[model samples]
Target: MAELRTEEEQVEALKRWWKENGLSLVAGVALAAAGVLGWNTWQGYQENQATAASMRYQQLVNLTAGNDLDEAQLPEARALVDEIVDEHGKTLYADLARLMDARLAVAQGDLAGARERLQSLADAGSDNYVAGLARLRLARLLVAEGDADQALNVLQSGVPEALAAQRAEVRGDAYHALERREEAATAWREALRLAATNEQPLYGVQLKLDNLGLESPDLEGSALETSSRDTTSHDNRGLDA
Candidate 1:
């Protein structure tokens, strides 16, 4: 009977040990799991905040469209854009805002200011699309200022494939302005080739060819006179019949 009591006591002690330490072990593991979940939730919240900042940046863009920089509202728009860029420069919208601001400066006829803004965007690292746009616009401004050589240099340096047709067309215009007719024609031809078939305007290409005294088979006929006569006859028939 004593041996039996000793065995019962040993079993009860084992049960107590398991009840106390096992519960604590399980609780510890659960706490560690919860901590991981909490960390992930915090990271997601931070990402969401950055995304909201970007959306606000886009709203600033809509507000500034076609608005004169000298107006009262312009300062407010600029302030919002600047805030986003300063606070969330890592966001894609920040880079886009800089490009938008530079374009606005250009539209306002602030060539010096535009160039300065564009230069900053161009030098910003890892923004290939914006940098390319800056270079292309800067080249156009240079051409407008009668700096054909510099414009050509900008084109020769590099331009993105998406802007190739526009670059070629502008370069052709610059060359034509410089009295380099052959170069202009060559550039225009390249532009025509690069342009999508459906998107390219045939009349503009024909005009360019004519400016270079180049004969275009497409414009060979007196189609305009015939169309005009047909339209006149149609109008007269309604009156007569």
Candidate 2:
């Protein structure tokens, strides 16, 4: 009889312990399961969003290929670009779309629009590569517009290493426009060096130097050649005297 009584007491103790902890344990497990489900759902949604954005960006690219975007195509291209900007503005594609839009503006001879687009991208702390590209384009446009000083100022801020050669080239152009021949030569030389380091093809810099009749080696040699010529002329004058 004592053993039976002890068994009953033990059963009662177990029941009370379960009553105290069972609900809390069940609730904790349910919360954990919900959190896991929520996380998975969120991940799936983000993946889908990215895929959709990529498709849209590809469509934008297809519409703008190899043509000047004639009047009929222009509106469609612009609309597609705008849609990308509106829906995926935070994505890399949006920045690309903006860059494309700037190019379109240029093709249309809308210099002001292109300048505005490029300037905003450059000034807005955009992705480093895109911003560097915008800055380079803007500087070129400024040079084309006969604003070499402003072009120089625009490029004074540093660019990404990938763009260093292009930036140097543009700087050289601006300096040449300003008739700062020596500075222009220095910039072109730096540009050539950077291009070689990056394995990039640089054109026209050598030609520009040649046109200046100051192709570096000749620049040094020209002074000596001129002095020699002067000395010869002086000797001939002495003979004549």
Candidate 3:
């Protein structure tokens, strides 16, 4: 009889304890499960968004791959660039699309628009490689626009080390534009050396050197002869992409 009474008292104690704590215990478990589910859903959503962006960017690349984009195709290509930037502005694809947008502006003979886009990217103050690319391209445009002084000013600040070859090349172009032949020769020589060290396949540097009455070992193969003419005519070829 004593044992039975002790067992009954213990059972009553457990029931009272559960009544006091069970609601909070159950709520805690429910909250944890919801947190896990929410995190999983968020991850899935991000994956889907990235996939969509990749597909769209690929489409843009295909459309703009060749130099023969017709008049009708140009508008379509620009629309894709806008769409990528609008939805995925923070993405690499968006940055590349902006680069393409700048090129499109050039094709349409909108030099001012090209400068605006390139300058925005250059001044974004990011350490991204794309920013370095932007600076280089912007310098090219500034030179093309007969703003060689401004181009030199833009290049006064540094670019990504990987882009040092192109930076030197552009400096040469700017100097060449300003009729500073000796400095252009010096910069072009440095560019050739750095290009070889960087293995970055810089084109037309040899031709520039040769034009300046300096000879460099051929660096760009068949491009050695043609690069000078292309750059002389276009002033925007050989962007480091």
Candidate 4:
């Protein structure tokens, strides 16, 4: 009889514990399942968005390919750029699109618009590579527009290490525009050295140095090696996208 009573007491204790914790346990499992479902849905949505953006970006590329920016081609290309930027601003595609848009602006002879777009991207600094590229291009435009001082200022900083060669090249251009031949030669030499280090092909830099009566004998093999890699290379600026 004592054993039966003890068994009944244990059963009652278990029942009470379940009554206290069962609801919370069920709620926790439901929450976990819901969380998983929500996460999957979010992932699916993100994948779909990425696919759409990539497709549209490809269309933009097709339109702008080969530098065939004719009257009919420019409008469609610019529209595609706007579409990608507006719909997918968070993606790298959008950043690339904005850069393409700047190019379109330049092609249309809208220098002010080009400057605005480049300035905006450079100021965004959202992506270091893209921002640095924007600054470089903008500096070139500034130098072309007789604003060499501003170009020099723009090239003073914010360029990425990967693009240090290009930055130096643009700085050289700005200095040349300002008739600072010695500084231009120095900057171009630094550019050649950096380009060699990074194995990035820089066109006409050696020629610029030659014009300035400067020579870098250490770059003889570098020039041949880097230029050899250039002919087979495709535009990889969109890889970030």
| Predictions in order: lDDT | 0.57, 0.66, 0.69, 0.71
Mark the 10 consecutive residues where model 1 has the least summed lDDT.
Answer: 232-241
- Predict model 2's lDDT versus the native: 0.66
Residue 155 error for model 3, in Å? Answer: 1.1
Q: Candidate 1 at 103: error in angstroms? A: 2.3
Provide the TM-score for each candidate, comma-separated. 0.62, 0.69, 0.73, 0.76
Number of the candidate with higher TM-score, 3 or 4: 4
Query: In candidate 3, which residue pairs get closer than 3 Å at backbone N, Cα or C atoms, i.e. clash?
Result: none
lDDT of 1 at 198: 24
Model 4: residue 48 alpha-carbon error in angstroms = 1.4
Window of ten residues with lowest summed lDDT in model 3: 1-10
Q: List model 2 lDDT by residue over 50-131, tens digit each.
A: 6887788778667766533566677788888898889878666677678778767776778889889988988873366667
lDDT of 4 by residue, 1-241 (tens): 2123222322343354356556874565466657467756655665688799889987986787654467789999989998998898876678777877887887788889998999999999456667777787788788878898998898888887867887887888888889999889888878878877776667666666666775455554566455434433222111111
Give the Cα error of residue 111 in candidate 4, in Å: 0.2
Query: Which segments of model 4 are wrong by more than 4 Å?
Result: 1-37, 215-217, 220-241
* Residue 176, candidate 4: C-alpha displacement in angstroms: 1.0
Top candidate on TM-score is: 4
Candidate number that wins on TM-score, 1 or 4: 4
* Model 4 root-mean-square deviation: 20.7
Those runs of model 1 whose alpha carbons end farther than 4 Å from true positions after fitting are 1-39, 67-70, 197-213, 216-241
Q: Is candidate 1 or candidate 4 better by lDDT?
A: 4
